[model samples]
Target: MDIAEINLQSRYVFRERISLMVLLCASSGRGFQVIPTSGMTLRSRSEHHLSNGDKYKDNVNALLLVATLVATVAFAAGFTVPGGFSSSPPNLGMAILANELDFCYFLLCNTLAMQCSVVAIVALIWAQLGDPELIHRAFHLALPSLFVALISMSAAFLFGVVATRRSHNNFLFNVVFNTVTAIFFHVMVLLLGPYVIPQLPGVPFL
Candidate 1:
């Protein structure tokens, strides 16, 4: 009578109907015929659900815009290193941080962020192409790629900050900067780890 009981009853009835349908299909010689129809019906329903919904389209477009922007920033960051580049003859216009370990870390993080953002953009574009299956796959790919891109961008930012001031002898500044970076990293992991980790493929459930 109540909503909970009603929901339970509805689910039970639905399961019963599905089992009965399966049984009938198996008993009939038209089992193969039923399978394609069921699959097509499911696909059609999914496509309609994704395409006909204005909210989904709007959300996807917003995400696409954000991902594209992040990708652009990351790509630009890769070309312009912290502290500028050396303009000397032998090392004409090479990054000044080229020899530093943190610079390498920054480059790796920035490159990863750029690559992941690009992938997320691609996935969003694919979702807009009106294929339900592709849309599903796109979400699976986009969410994780966007998560990684965000995390990597944060790392790149931290490393870039460190690389720029590494030559300074101000112990207090270094300590404060490192503390802030640590806090930022921890906050990001705490906020995003739960959502991103479980969604990743091949992760074993605890």
Candidate 2:
């Protein structure tokens, strides 16, 4: 190579070395160096993971509380059934409206609610073991179980009320039935409408 070309190449190499030295010096302090890009990325990932863990814990705690409450109420309802127990010797200790269709529905719904809540409780307990993958799977199971428990509990309440009411209180029964049905519909819409609305062609907001 010519001297001029070699001189130019040397200048370029010197400039690159200077730039690299400056960068290195800027990154190094008295006793420590700034984190490299890979280190920063790992730190950010750790932070994100911790944040997700906290969020999962919060969700589990809230759902656990709700499941516990539902289980408690359903257990109590099983013992003190609608219309109370029969006092007569022939049918003592039996639910008074046990033969009624509405009472049968109430029992079925209550049992479903209790079972679902118990499942949710168990799933949420598994979610607390501090493993991200396990926590995610547990939440998947717990959320649907909790939702079903809530729905079943509401249905049980409605059926129990109906079974205990007298025919003379027809107006009151209608009011109660309408109120509960409306509330159920409202909740279902709030929970499921987002998923359902987009699937319908030309449908507006729910």
Winner by lDDT? 1
Q: Quote the lDDT for 148 in model 2.
A: 73
**Best model number under TM-score:** 1
Query: Ten consecutive residues with minimal summed lDDT in candidate 1?
Result: 33-42
| Candidate 1 lDDT over residue span 1-206, tens digit each | 12222232212343453443343344444312222111111222233544343434665787798899889989999888887989897889999889988889999999999999999999999888766567656766776688799989989988888888756789899889889888988898766554334221222220
Per-candidate alpha-carbon RMSD to the true structure: 10.2, 18.7
TM-score of each: 0.69, 0.65
lDDT of each candidate versus the true structure: 0.67, 0.65
Whole-model lDDT, model 2: 0.65
Worst 10 residues of 2 by lDDT: 35-44
lDDT of 2 by residue, 78-158 (tens): 998989988888998888887899999999999999999999999889878766666656655666677778878988998
- Candidate 1 lDDT (Cα, 0 to 1): 0.67
